[model samples]
Target: MPLWLPVGMVAGVAGWFWLPGEQAWEGLLLSMAALALAGFAFGRGGRAGRSVAIFALSVAIGCGLIWWKAERAGAPVLARDGIANLTARIERVEPLPARQAVRVTLLPLSCSDEGRSAGVCDAALAPQHSRLRRSAVGVIRINIPDENAVPGLAPGAVIALRARLVPPPSAAVPGAYDYSAVAWFSGIPATGKALDPVKLITPAPTGGPAEWLADARIGLTAHIMTELPPGQAGVAAALVTGDMGGVTQDDNDAFRRSGLAHLLSVSGLHLTAAVGATMFLALRLLALWPRLALRAPLLLIAAGCGAVMGIAYTLLTGAEVPTVRSLIAALVVLAGVALGREAMTLRLVAAGALVCVLFWPESVAGPSFQLSFAAILSIVALHELQWTRRTFEKREEPWLRRLLRELAALLLTGLVVEAALAPIAIFHFHRAGLYGAAANIVAIPLTTFVIMPAEALALIADCVGLGAPFWWVTGRALALLLWIAHSVGSLPGAVTFVPTMSRAAFALIAVGGLWLALWRTRARLLGLLPIAAGAAMTLATHPADIFITGDGRHLAVRGLDGRVALLRERTGDYMRDTLSEISGREGDDAIALDDLPGAVCGPDSCTATLIRDNRVWHLLATRSAYRIDRAAMEPACAAADIVASDRRLPDWCRPRWLKADPNLLAKTGGLAIRLVDPGVTSVAELQAAHPWAMVATDHDDRPLPQNDPNFARRAWAARDPWRDDRPADAGGMQR
Candidate 1:
């Protein structure tokens, strides 16, 4: 019934995949046709029927659009297993400061056979020359260990390298981030590490507008880094070029904890600052000449200039989702100005959201999109309410009073935004910045009033070779800002870890928040029901007792005393820290085998036991713990109630014993096991119960079997041929 129906449609289409199964295009089409027919039939009725018709039509259109987009962005043809000589043109490059690596996304130009000698980049032997010729335009991500690899690498540069290209990995554990899905939508077919050094065959030439813009950004970032201190330079570069590679991990963590992480991203705030500053300067200069100001519609002209500046900034920053959303909103306002109409904030926001969803549908699932839109909607709703109330009480206020009112409004806006985004932040990131409101109160004004304007001036000055002084001043300001972040972040209780919430609970909370924000009546109080229910559901959920990595190399189980016992000595710090936080473990100190109760360690294996509900659950980390001999492994497996290892166990290991070896791990992705009296239930098993589990497969979307009969036999024989002494009829047991 409203123009925002398209936005709802977009949401429906995006969320369709959340239902647990592969959606059939035929069924979707039939349902849509039925809905359209029903809508048409209902349109003959009164206003109420028309409203129902509109809702049905919206759902139909949304489902159709989602299905169409999925069909268009189909899975790419992946490389075969093993190393291949790849000749590709670099499409994008990002530096990983933490990994000391350069991640390059490339478009494959050619591929050599797996066994071909590494350094071959002949155009004649390209994809066209071989059967590996691929017609689909897909991107491949390659991570080169050398940091220097990306120094001169720009988009459009042709290069060659040998690498073992694998499909993007699925979640390491259930409920974790699904990077494979991200890759699917992003059109990245494969990801791998460079086995040989990346050889640049041809340097990128300044050919097109996009290339020129990228080169300019790269050059400007380098100049800024050269002109400022490392930390200050990093912030400046991010503000200017959206290149955050130089930002150190320590500073990143500090900013995030201090609730200033939004400042690092080039979003609505940055765009508004640049465009508003440009418009202000343009109008000021135009007013100096009465003839020109009078002849031209000054506001319109200024708005046009602002629009142009916003577009330029968007292009310069790669037109990311947040930037695009902001740009669309600004354009809507500018359009209203051009048409001599007052821009309604709600309508403009809705229009911008519709445009973003139409173009970048996947963005609906992203935190940036959700958080950005939610905060803006909340602020707009609050502002509208305040304006309405103020309209009734008309009293002229002094300048000092007006200034104080504005400051209070600013503080209120920050508080509203933080409150609105809290649930989303917790759901996605599992952490809430405790002092986000306080941090925003201090940081927003400094960024909006001081830093951004200075940065804009510096950019203009840089063009005329007079940027050094301005950059120096900007750097000093940034340093002070960083100091604030550090100080605030170091304060006690800066951030609190929130447990993960179920998708259903999060959806309920989101729906409730939207209802409260959008409706302007006492009926809005009804939103409290769903919100309260979501909170209750989250509190009722329990943490996993045992978790295992996708590779089955590491396992962490909660002991009876509520302490987490890490089975392996060497586990990734990231995984360990994440699990520790989930288990409510304090500090980052590595928990040793000796420190864990009921943990018995042998030369190369360890067994940990957990007693729960009058039942004992034994976990065995076999040769994978340290590659113990079969003699050592047999005792650990034979005695254990549940076993996890990289290698498969002997046939004598029967069905009664729960086995989590490499084969099972490969199929499950990662596992979170809950020990019960009768048996154990895993995250994988619960996920598999849903029909969508069959559709959501490995990186290539190939359905992996839960149990492979030959898996263990092949795995055991592969390790040591002479050690395959099991009976011929012995078969593998499913978990």
Candidate 2:
């Protein structure tokens, strides 16, 4: 029952996210009340009935928690896009490549609609407020280039600057990661870049513990960076402080490909290692005095010390979600040691998950939470297996034989963990490391036993100005770790990319995995059936052939040769990379659309033809010109299967199927269409099939009520949120 509670909570949270429109609290309350009553009544019934009632009640409670959380996090976003002279307090600061990214609480003293003439207002149009103060309600992420970097800017420091603020953008393409939803729940309403140099208005407070910790962390990062060389400095900081902001993209990719990415982050492995080392050392020192060790409860004392150290490490490293989750589990293990009971079980994992779901419910949807929990669960399940237990049991054996046995066990566990995490990796990242298991067998022990301890000692020695020796050892170890990562990652076929799978398919796999892990009897083997089915379903799915950005400026088409061709040769790297990922052609570079055979480009528009299943489909997209005559393009538009442009097409210029102009895209967020021999005929059919991916704009896609005073008015008549057809707004925001 304890194991099932976290599953029920996750289901409820996922359901809340999948729910469309506003949720009614009264309905949820009623349902929860009914479930509670059922549980009480079933208390007098059979065991199965009671179990079912408890599970239903848990689900209801999960839903209620999310609903309540939404209300608490309902901070208002920016009402419109405009350049403003704003004053804000910096909540956090992260160093970026040649820039400083900071999250700030906005204090809007004035705003200017003059940005409208410059096109900034077009990219993020929101409903105008009669009074604008209601719009400046939440945190905003602002990036300041190095030229404007202000020294001594830390958390709690207030600064004033002129910047163009826009609401957080939705997914640029359908089925892509949605940053806007994440921002909403995290209390960040907007993102922008500073236009002018920032002027410090107020200094960081000297009294608050949070501010002190922030400053200390920043100081430590700076110290480590100064002590070590560039590559080693970045990795060292990440290992000690959970600050990946200093890590270069190349190194990050290498770690990810080599399956050593988890080492770069402070998570379960790091926490557990720290706790174990602390207790081990404490017990060893205590045993030096045999009287003290025998007279006192040394193990309990060590457990208590380990708990304190774990909490300190968690806080010093910023207490990220995964760290906090692992800290909870570590505390449980420490408790077990103190109380003389077994603690490393599924129940311990469930308790940790339950705490996270209750506090940071949104994390359940993110990759970090999913991956961390999945890895730990798989490891625990393997350990609990009877065959694994008997094989690894302590016995009289030769030293060399025992050493080989331990090595074999390590490799076997790594294989099992990598297999468990592969599907999740593909689901979120579109790729999984092929040789991660072998790489980790070397990397994990190196990180746990050698590097981390050296770094910790170096940090401790830094206080007395004697850390150079330790830092040198640490740097050498980090270099060795990097060598292993690059060596393994550079191997042929180090990573495999898969297209995104449907939510249903992913859920089936997750359920099957959980069933296999949670159960102990022969019934657990039945999970193989659903796992196979999910894998088949994923294999059956196809990637969309065409991609459109939310702004309708960038379009990509996968040609017959399976290479993606982009509309703009000089598109942003982010757009190109995302297109490659989603199209499952990341290994191949995207070419200019006009470079493809049988594609034509004119001054006004470009046309590309694709042959799919023996049927020809034409895609027509307008160039970035001021105007194109609808009358001249009517014949071509009518013949094409897909018509897309930055501007709205005329009524008579209807395409055979899709119309992905700014107006349509504003409502749909972004579109990824897979061409079929028999495709969707009308906009209504497409809407019904795909549904709306996001509530991107304020404009209503449906007809207004007949009795309403604005019924006769067309909602589409308003300026589209991301439309930049006019020259002024066109030059405002390129992205």
Candidate 3:
């Protein structure tokens, strides 16, 4: 309950996230020593000294814990890279939302380099080679192209597959999502694609708790599908189970835009409702038995029952990060009831957060953890204020007056939570739900009073063989909820895209928010200084001049007119969406290169010119545009200040001019370039300024050359050099 607990854990998470990967072990040892010294000082020092020592101890402990977790979750180093024949057991199978592929987590039982002497290959894998001899080689994610081909695949199923094994990827751009760090913390060593059909050799063990739960979830989802329309069923299933695969992309987008997306996830709201409803029903039933009720402490009994139900539901929903967070909170509340202590205070929330950080340190980096804790802490702080108490003091009036008070309370709570979470939402998702308060006003009451209650009843009925009617009714409520979401989402400017802010700015804002939420004194007003600073930083930041995908296939640049111009008409959805979000652009209407104000698109290439600081710079997308003759290639290379192509160019290409090809792209990953007075700066250079710079390099230092002889031969063999539609060249620009 001490503020130090959460603060320390946060410091530790920050250390882990930002510290150099190679020095993690060293940092761990140093932190432990510092923690010991601080603890000693805290126990022996005077009052003021004790406070300082406790703060130091907390930070040290945080750093130690983070390093400890990082060490435990280190990625596996395969005995051999490239194609490998692996025998493994499926630990989990999830269908990516709105995607055709199925992502499966596999525990490798054995792996051997392809074409090697099968019996002589190394059976020992990096993650499982420790003294404990655990067989898990860390979980590896494999994307199976055809979901139907692995329709019967479930957890515990053993299969053999040939896959191109590779280490997890790093952040594609600086400040972008770090896939490698996420995977590493989750104990995922590598990711790959199944080269052929997964040959299932064994089925899942029957009657196990995990297997039973999986089967139950699948069956419930299937039943929902049968009883309700596709969209309604998907929403219903999402509420009941954590499976979001059934929800259509459009519906998902609508919910997100309308600020109703939280309802779809199994988070605090759902857990709280389920537990509260269960306890309420249990208490009513207990009261019917007068003699039993007289002897037993009803509150404690109800708390016990609620705790059990919360745990059961969390497990049923696969105990994802948010659910686990909710479960921890429920248990804390139950414990408080058993001990006759007031719950739902800041201390209880801090306790829940401390537990989550200890067990799931990686979650600290996720948006859900930040937003959930912020909202809860803000609500508690708001409730503790004198003004809020005064508003509720005169509550013993008429029913209509009570109803009005409750409505006002709900509105206030929603507003506070939205306000608390807005910065985090913008920082993580780059969008603010403009109508979130209005949407919550209509949607929260309906969901809490009708939809969730109906869902709980439907779940109970389904267990007792009277579920179809309840499910049908539940679907109707869900349909209406969706209607509300759609209506809100359809409003003009329902979602406002914001540019990504620097880590320093986000950290400043977070610290300011926490200071405001944690303190009750008038001094809490001081928190506004850092908040204002962060806001100013955000306003002063500028969008990148050029954005390139990791694959070196897509490119976009900010034209002189301050509008984004795409190099190609067709681009991946992820890239397009990311660009739109970061550039504060609506929809996908960013002008194509040919349509830009000062750009020219030829058969084989597109060229644009931007003048800044009395300098005229030319940008050319020459690759894969059309077949270009030698003479044309030389002129294009000589003329342009930046050339982005995917093909090999002659050595005569200007060395001072930036040339982006697949090789440099492979090394640098994705790029976000800004045009400075003299030249350009890149995300990679900015990243190198941070201590965590090597985390990405640690994944793969020597990527295969972009123009590997054997690879190029195979790659070009299928294409015609003279094809008119083909771009002249395409590759990453040199750093």
Query: Using TM-score as the measure, which candidate wins?
Result: 2
Give per-residue CA lDDT, model 3, range 18-122, as digits (tens).
554436635654765676576566667565556555665666667667766756665454433467787889898765434666778888777665513322123
Candidate 1 on 1-735: residue-level lDDT in tens?
Answer: 364475567546645555433455446546756775776686677776566666666666676666556555634435334577888998887655446677888887888855233212233222311213334647888888873374468888999888877656656665566666667677665678898878899989787997898788777777777877888888888887788887887898789889899999999889888888879988999999999988988888898999999999998987777888888888888889778887757777778777877787767777888888888888887877866457433357887877777677777777888888888887877777778888888788888888777877887898899987787778878988899899999888887766467788988888788778777788888988999999889888776677776777767776655566776666667677666655545326447554687776654566665665555556676544444455545544565656777775565553224577765665565766655322333345434422113123233332232344343344334444233233221111111
Q: Could you say which candidate leads in lDDT?
A: 2
- Residue 647, model 1, lDDT: 70
Q: What is the lDDT of residue 148 in candidate 2?
A: 74
Count of clashes, each model: 2, 1, 25
Candidate 3, 395: how far from true, in Å? Answer: 1.3
Q: Output the worst ten-in-a-row residue range by lDDT, candidate 1.
A: 726-735
Q: Please, what is the whole-model Cα lDDT of each candidate in the order they appear?
A: 0.69, 0.74, 0.71
The digit string of per-residue lDDT tens for model 2 on 1-735 reads: 568888888877766665542344445546766876776686777776677677777777777788667655634555546676667778777665312344344434333456433223323333232222223355678878767768868888788888877767767775666676677677666678888888988888887889888888888888888898888888889888888877877788799889999998999889988899999999999989989988999999999989998998899898888899989989998998899999998898898889999998888878888999999899899999999999987779999999988989999989999989998988877788889999998999999999999999999998999988999899999999999998998898898878667667888899899999988999999888888888899889877788888788988887776688988877877788778777766634689888977677765678876766655566788868666655457767776667888777777777655677877776665677776423221122222211112344565363212113342122213533133222222111111
Which pairs of residues collide in model 2? 119-729
- Position 137, candidate 2: lDDT: 53
| TM-score of each model, in listed order | 0.85, 0.88, 0.86
Per-candidate Cα RMSD to the true structure, in Å, reads 7.1, 7.1, 7.4
Candidate with the larger TM-score of 1 and 3: 3
Q: How accurate is candidate 3 locally (lDDT)?
A: 0.71
